[model samples]
Target: MKNVLRIIGAILGIVLAVYLVYQLRTIFVYIILAVVLSLLGRPLMNLLGKIRIKNFRLPNSLSALIVLIVMILFVVGIFSLFVPLIAQQARIVSSIEANEVARAFAEPLNRFSQFLADYELTEERFDEHYFRAQIRDILKFGKVSSVFQSIFGVLGNLFIAIFSVLFMGFFFLRDGMLLQRILETLVPDAEVPHVRVILDNTKRLLTRYCFGLVIQVALVTLIISVSLKFFLGIENALIIGFMAGLLNLIPYLGPVMGAILGVIIVMLTNLDLNFYSELLPKSGWILVIFACMQLFDNMITQPVLFANVVNAHPLEIFIVISVAGTLYGITGMIIAIPSYTVLRIIAKELFSQYKVVSSLTRNL
Candidate 1:
């Protein structure tokens, strides 16, 4: 009876905690971003700390501030370079008329729909006017004014989020032990030492993983951008390439998603061209380029970076990411490896006696 009471109490506590977390999710997001920034900046902070000039070493606060500034500058520089270009291209694409696009491609769409109908694949006949309306509906949100309006609408929340992340990130970087101290208070006194071990292990692993991830994203972005610039002469190649690199963060499914997006963007921008001869062929070539990129990533990039950084097998990473994606979607897939790494470390520390834990965390 006592055990049952204890179990029920624990369940209720968990439920309440989850409710609180959901309610305060925005704050949690800020904290998580700060933690990720700190993780990425830690090595730079340490390196700065080691600098000496005439028996003078940089203070923690100064080092942390410098690191934070450098990170901010890096992000700002990238945005400054790409944002205007992308925005201009977006304006141009948004100004495109749905009737113009529909007039150019409507026949092909109808023929494809008729083929489907002929094969009894779809009972509904494709209407040209309906198709043009659909095109207008799709392009409505593609309007530059609409896009900027959406962003403007969220400016207040966005500012708060950015400021909160920056504020917390500075402190986290400055006081390397800040996060540890917070955890120490939350963790039980008896289990503090064990928890500290888990924290250190998780941080070290995640730091390496994050570094490798940034490098991977950079390499992918450079390749795709260069390929499109030189091979296809696309105007907004950088935008598409950056998006592809970002999406490639997800395993298995991300490359295909990026490819589809690439096709859409290409088609949208090239709407004035011949659909079958120029536009369709260009879109096809995009698929080929993305396919080649995938092959290269699978053959060279992923194996080298992730295998070393995560210390897990391909199959293991795939299963974990797939399960996470199923449960929590794109965000889950993005965080799956780090989450799995931390879970494995915890299991190895606390449940090493169990055979399954031992087997799964063998690399760790």
Candidate 2:
């Protein structure tokens, strides 16, 4: 009777905790951002600490402030560089005429439609006319002003969020164990050692993973930009490269989406060219470039980041990412491996007696 009651009480506690977390999700977001900032900024903080004038070194507060400013400037610089390019592309897509696009591709599109019909692949007729309608639907964005207005509306509280995150991040960088100290107060005194170990392991693993992501994005961007520049006649190769790099954040599915986007943009830019002989050739080369990039990424980069850095098996990472993507979508997929790594660290400390936990966290 006592055991049954205890089990029910435990389940109720878990439910209540989840409910509270959901209510305070925004605060959690800020904390997560602060933690990430602290991780990224810690190296700079260490470097600043080593700098001295005679016998005096930089203070922790001063170091943290410098690190914070540098990170902010980097972020602002990235936005400044990319935002205008993106906005320009969006304007081009939004303002382009569907009729003109259809007319440009009409000959090849008609031939392709006939091929599909001859093969009985399409149920109803599919031709340039059907594609012409899709052109408007696919590229439709009312205006750039309206789009940024919606973005500004959504980020209305962005100032407060940034300030809160920076404040927390400064302290986190100043005192590396600040997060662990806070977590300790929540757990029992007996569990303090476990919490400390968990936080330490998570920090190291996540730092490597985060840096790996940066390298991957930059490398992918470079490959795509170079490919488009030399192999294709596209005018907006830089913007397309940036788009591919950003979308590559979504694991497994990202490369395919990037390829499709590359093709679409290729068609859009070369509307004045002959679709069959001229445009098609360029599009084919772009796909080949994307394919080669993906092959390199999958074979080399992903294994190192997702498997080696996290100390998890490749199959284990795949399953975890798949489940997270199914449950919470793209954002979930992006964070899945890191989140799972943290969970494994915690479980190793707290549930090592369990066989499954022991096996999964054996590497950690």
Candidate 3:
């Protein structure tokens, strides 16, 4: 009868899990952002606690406040330096016709046309009209005007994200113990220790993942900004470099997107691309920025993870990112690593409970 009850409970749990995932999809983004923010803030919160900065050993809310202020100032500083340049570039781009710009900048397309003509390729089979229409459609769909609108839309999302993070971080930092105790009250006394272990593992993994990424991202941004100033000039460097660095947080798609932005900025500005004509086709300068970021992330970021945090397999990490991007696009990509860390902890626990699997994974 005990075994029968356990079987029934297991089946019920599976059904409940599927239902919960379907229902919780929308709220998942908010929960993830909150979790990431709280994790990033935890180390500073701990430092404050250790320093006895609170009133008579009581918790201080000021640590979270200070972190928030620093983050805002950092963002503001970057914006102040670059927004005007980007705006001027935008005006220049807006004043140009597509055909005129293409004449001025579409050398790649001209080369392709030359290749096709030289090869005596069947123009009819290529359906140049159809291709042109498709190109026009894509251009319309992804126009600079639409991109500017999307940027403004993201500003609203940024505010919502910030508000949610602060609200969640404050409570997590101040009253997380109380919340855990409440959760503990709901669990069976005998199983509470096991549950506590799970929660602690989750907290530690998330904290390391978030805090490490924050430092990593900040370092990458600083490196790109400095490199851009040295190589590209400060006229449009800060904003472009910062945007690229921030997007680099998204993984595979980021560097390419950033390079495109760099190219667009170069096209819009009065900078003398002719001087670097030899280096232009190779995109050596943009490549340098990406190479530096990749080097820093691999040499600096991954080594720190290996030294301190759990060492996830590269293939496992890739699959997690692919799955995450498929499900939630950019946001999913950002959250995928920490989410995998949480899953890895759970998987280890479940595997350890089964003798056969334990033997198989023990060597891992």
Which candidate gets the maximum lDDT versus the true structure?
1
**Model 3 — TM-score against the truth?**
0.77
What's the residue-level lDDT of 94 in candidate 3? 64
Instruction: Report the number of backbone clashes for model 3.
Output: 0
Per residue, candidate 1 scores C-alpha lDDT tens digits across 10-41 of 56966987688668967876887899899999
lDDT of 2 by residue, 1-364 (tens): 9867855875696689768866897788789889998998888888898899999988898899889999989989977988998888878876678898888877777888889889999876567799888876665566546777888977978888989999999999999878888889997898798888888888888888888888899889888998898777577888788889989999888888998998998788668887678888888888899999999998888787666557777798899999989977897898887888888887788768778989998988
Best by TM-score: 1
Listed in order, each prediction's TM-score against the native is: 0.88, 0.87, 0.77
Q: Which pairs, if any, clash in model 3?
A: none
Off by over 4 Å in 1: 1-24, 139-149, 313-315
Clashing pairs in 1: none
For model 1 the TM-score comes to: 0.88
Report the Cα lDDT for residue 91, model 3: 81
- Candidate lDDT (C-alpha), each: 0.85, 0.84, 0.66
